[model samples]
Target: MALMTTDTRYTKVAIALHWAIAALILCNLALGFFMEGFEQPLRGFVIQTHISSGITVLLLSIVRIVWRLTHRPPPFAPGTRGWEKGLAHLVHFLLYVAMVLMPLSGWALISANPPPPPPGQIEAAPAPVPGGAAPAAAAPKARRGGPTKLWWVIPWPKIGPIQRMGTTPQGIAEQKLLHDTLVERHMQIAWIIIALLVLHVGGALKHQFVDGQAEFARMGIGRGRRAPR
Candidate 1:
């Protein structure tokens, strides 16, 4: 069993991961909202950045989970009610679920409906012949649905089964339906994460300001106070 500690603040590693993940989540959320306004290459770049951030979050979250399992966090501040503790735990659990599922559902959506060819991949039409008759245009390169690069660096493969879904006409229809469903789920989970964040931050502020507890200090943000008995 992990040692139960009376330590007032989170360990350095935990504190680092917490802030890093929070920053990435906020940035990715902004990217998701604004990406549509961008044109071609720029839009693609934004999307690649978002995907890279999401994958990073997933990896860091796994590390955080392992760290949590092995290291006991400080107990609740004194004067905390039983209901408050229960709500805190529930909100935390849901947040974890949202973080993991949001990226995965996005991955599935893209796999089912691969993005269009990136800039410079599509061939241009052949110039008009001497008689003012246009020769046959070259066939555009096949859309193989290539892997998404992490921040335009490391290659990240899509989910194979979903990536291969729309080869045939019948399969195309099925893939479209699946893609639509995943899109809806992905948006739904984003909203859930937002709501949970509000509750989590609100509770922390309440403890710190309203109840006179050193809440931020427990997360390694500020100076510690004596735990209420």
Candidate 2:
């Protein structure tokens, strides 16, 4: 791997976090779509994974933002255009917005819905049957949405009264409405993020190949060539 000189490249930590978050976002996007066809157990598992990955992206983004504030990005490659630079900055700003909003919206949506039981706790036993040998299973209830345990291991703290609002008919109906509205917003923003990513990557590749700039290298991806001053 050819590394750019420190003067012309991102710090290793920034590069690492950049790629890691990119991979996680891409993976979660795919999983979100993929879960549509899955059945109960598998769907539940995939949704949990998507939520966990998204939350991880949110946390990493926070750290990356801090790193960015303290550290200057590598200087632009030689001959980069004013319009191109403006567009790049715009895309980056939108990306940060999406990164911050996507996960928060998802978490909020989950919080607004009914929460699931804390990790590792067995669901309450079904009420006893009136006269049969086997106890009747409680009627399957609609998922109002709720606190999601991360990686099926770490418990996210219960967030709001919304989680506790599902016990009554009116509350359940209200929670479901909130859940649907949030899901729509979350998905719309996710798509916008993906579109911004396409533009961001397309611009970088254009610079790398069409413009003969070592743009990839500036992000620690490939070999760098020094431009004459």
Candidate 3:
């Protein structure tokens, strides 16, 4: 195979998207684990941020995948070990798959749960008029049935009919089961992604320092080139 030249580097757009997605994923993972520690309003706020960030990841991942399909990345440098190259390819593929699935599972889980009631202003009861009776209390507005909004701003579409299932007693039990199942799956996949990241980062460090390959530059960050591995 022809060795990719040292001059080859990812486009600036690809590099920007790559780092941005990485940052978002790390933040989302942290938020997922810690959001429950907060009280209601703050917890709600963090959850909103987490969901928004996850949606952003999904959107960026799609664009990244399209860009990658259309523009080939530079090949492994000269004398790269077969095992290292193979492992790198496998990790990269899995990361892409996780990026797509993580947010989707999250959205599904959110849809399974009911949307919170909108914040309402408190009103004083009207004073009794000179003669007769008190006014009837106003009925609450119906909850909008759909996917949870991103950051409580952009509306996201629901995945399954899970929201509807929550209405009945029997359905509530089923919804709880489904919601828990999806949460387990999402957390499991998250750990897989984290494990893959450790391997990926370790490999880069090995290539950069131990092998003196400057391999990290392929993603457009580190200095390019060194003695051949």
Candidate 4:
């Protein structure tokens, strides 16, 4: 039997990381869904924000994993079934995998096909010649992959191998194929994360409301009830 104590709650750092990552993931999901509807500079800004948020989630997830490995989580509320515990563990594991993979896949996607210049970087077409004929428009610059700024501030490098795929015909074709595959995979992983999140939240609610367990409290919501002895 386990002794009842407040010590059963997760560590403060774990709780902070959990909420931070959750918030970022939700925001990024929204951005991904609606980014296309935006026009021009706004669209570019939204996409960059999405990437920055994803990278932030990835970094925080790594920290959270390390914290989890070192610190023991509170035991399940008394009377919790073995199957419930197993399912919870499985969902958590998948969430972690999805969290890591989603950002990495996004990085790879961008690397394979570098994004166009942001609105600020694009040069305006020269005014038409005052007298007779319009000046010929300058040719658009070819996109050579480069570092992205996190939140338009910190520099985040592209995946070298993926970004360095040459400009040759063959290399371009391979890069395009890889980009398409990664785009599909990224969406697939997102759906998986959504499913896992549903399960996780539903399970917690079931335990807290139906079973009268201090589920949220264990994750630092409210005061935790004593663990069953």
Rate residue 61 of model 4 by lDDT.
91
lDDT of 4 at 151: 92
Look at candidate 3 and give me any clashing residue pairs. Answer: none
Where is model 4 more than 4 Å wrong at Cα? Answer: 1-6, 114-146, 226-229
Angstrom error at residue 119, model 3? 16
Model 3's TM-score against the true structure: 0.78
Compose the digit string of candidate 1's lDDT tens values, residues 1-229.
Answer: 1123345777677788889988999998889888989998898789889989998898888888888889878888889999999999999888877878888887788787533445776533334334433333332233335578887788887887886655444444456567768978988888888999999999999999999998998777878954333
Specify the highest-lDDT model's number. 4
Sorted by lDDT (best first), the order is: 4, 2, 1, 3
Name the regions of candidate 1 deviating beyond 4 angstroms: 1-6, 114-144, 225-229
Error (Å) of candidate 2 at residue 118 is 13
How do all models score by TM-score?
A: 0.82, 0.81, 0.78, 0.82
List per-prediction Cα lDDT, in the order shown: 0.76, 0.77, 0.75, 0.78
Q: lDDT (0-100) at residue 71 of candidate 3? A: 71
Q: Provide the lowest-lDDT 10-residue window in model 3.
A: 135-144
Per-residue lDDT of 211 in model 4: 96
RMSD (CA, Å), each prediction:
8.7, 7.8, 10.8, 9.2
Per-residue alpha-carbon lDDT of candidate 4 for residues 102-140, written as tens digits (9 for 90 to 100): 999998887885344456775333234335243334322
Error of 4 at 174 (Å): 0.5
Collision pairs in model 4? none
1-229: candidate 3 lDDT, tens digit per residue = 2232224566667788899999999999999999879998898689879989999999999999988887778777787899989999999999999999999898778777543334683422223333433322321122224446877888877755777665554544455566778999999989998999999899989988888785778777766754243
Q: Which stretches of candidate 2 lie over 4 Å from their true place?
A: 1-5, 115-140, 144-147, 164-169, 225-229
Alpha-carbon shift of residue 206 in model 3 (angstroms): 0.9
